[model samples]
Target: MKKFLIHIPLLVLSTTFTFISCTSSKNVDTNLPKDIAERPADEDSQKYEQAQLDKLKASIESESSREKCANASEWTFAPMGAKACGGPQQYIAFPKKMETTLLPRIEEYTQKVKAFNEKYNIVSDCMMIMPPTSVKCINGKAQLITAEQ
Candidate 1:
């Protein structure tokens, strides 16, 4: 019974110590003294922060430009089945508006592409070209010629 009582006090002390050790204290300046030195902002840190802000602004501008491109009444040409050359080429607008919406315009273009593919006796040397409103299938591929040259 004596040993148990002694151990109980020791256990309480250890628990109190553990609690004290685990408790996080924030060092806050409650009493502001006039003579306390105000820490100056580092020049390098300021420059880094400004650079990050500039990058963020640039990114925002880029995103806005892309949104404008996507929403604009512009036509995009794609080759029928050419893996590299047959995707959304560029923003082209016809003299007349195709439709009021983007989806219909894309669908119309897709049909045209399918027809072009069937009509043209295309080989690996075929190139899709954009001259404003129409997609032209040229005889030779630009990439192949460039590589050869």
Candidate 2:
């Protein structure tokens, strides 16, 4: 009886201590800047972003046979009048199943492309006009567009 009473207090104290320890919160430093770097800072990041933007612009406006188009992750958009376009960069012709979703997105995509092009001074030497080609899907592991024969 005495031994049990003594152990009960000790067990209760230990459990209470453990519970408090487990439930206690520690101060977390969440004020640190996410993308901040020391030397090649925001400027470098912007430059890299611009470079990628330029590449996207190029892929969108590519005309030559050597310039192959890449595939998009979810939905592909090939420009209406281009030979082929790259992923997210090239606007794809809508298939039967994709028309409903993609048709509306085309205008928005155009606006975005125009804005990005204008901001980056992407020359519209090969802007698509009319008669969109087949859409190649990225999900198929075949991520490149084959020009129409």
Candidate 3:
């Protein structure tokens, strides 16, 4: 009877150990990629990510330039000059008549800026056009008569 009791406890203990070991082994991790050759290709994914970043940068630049244009107090009719002008009094040669080409371009640019602003939810009082009397031509260059002038 004593031998039977001791054998029964040993049997139960061995059964418990077997169950624990089986459960632990089931939780082992074995699905990890074993080598670089087994990994997924990243080249195409990298290019796609770079293109998206470039597009975002371009949008930001466009928005920034539009905001600057909207905040500008005066517009100049500068041709044969840098794509962008600086300062209040600097001037560049005017290539066409102000009433036709220059005014139209200004209007077009303003409309574009307005549309961009509306799309991006930017708030500003831009696109204010100065009167003809506010314009002055010197050495074939047209400039706005700023307050300092």
Candidate achieving the largest lDDT? 2
Q: How many backbone clashes does every candidate have?
A: 0, 6, 0
2 or 3, greater by TM-score: 2
Model 3's alpha-carbon lDDT is 0.44
Please report how far candidate 3 places residue 37 from its true position, in Å. Answer: 27
* Number of the top-ranking candidate, with TM-score as the measure: 2
Candidate 1, 1-149: lDDT as tens digits: 99999999999999998887766433546565555355444654544444544454344334323332322224332222221235433343321233344335444544544444444533333355433434222332111112223
RMSD of 1: 19.2
Model 2 Cα lDDT, one tens digit per residue, 27-143: 445565666463344543546656654565455334222223344444344552222232233544333345465455554545555555555665544545443344455444323
What digit string (tens of lDDT, one per residue) describes model 3 on residues 1-149? 98999899899999999999999998877887899778765744544444543454355334323322221234344321111121111232233323354444444444444444444455443433332334454443344564556
Which model is ahead, 1 or 3, in terms of TM-score? 3
| lDDT agreement with native, every candidate | 0.41, 0.48, 0.44
Task: Give the candidates in order of TM-score, highest first.
Answer: 2, 3, 1
- Structural similarity to truth (TM-score) of each candidate: 0.22, 0.31, 0.28
Candidate 3, residue 56: CA error in Å?
A: 20
Worst-scoring 10-residue span by lDDT in model 1: 140-149
lDDT of 1: 0.41
Q: What number of backbone clashes does candidate 2 have, counting pairs of residues 3 or more apart or in separate chains?
A: 6
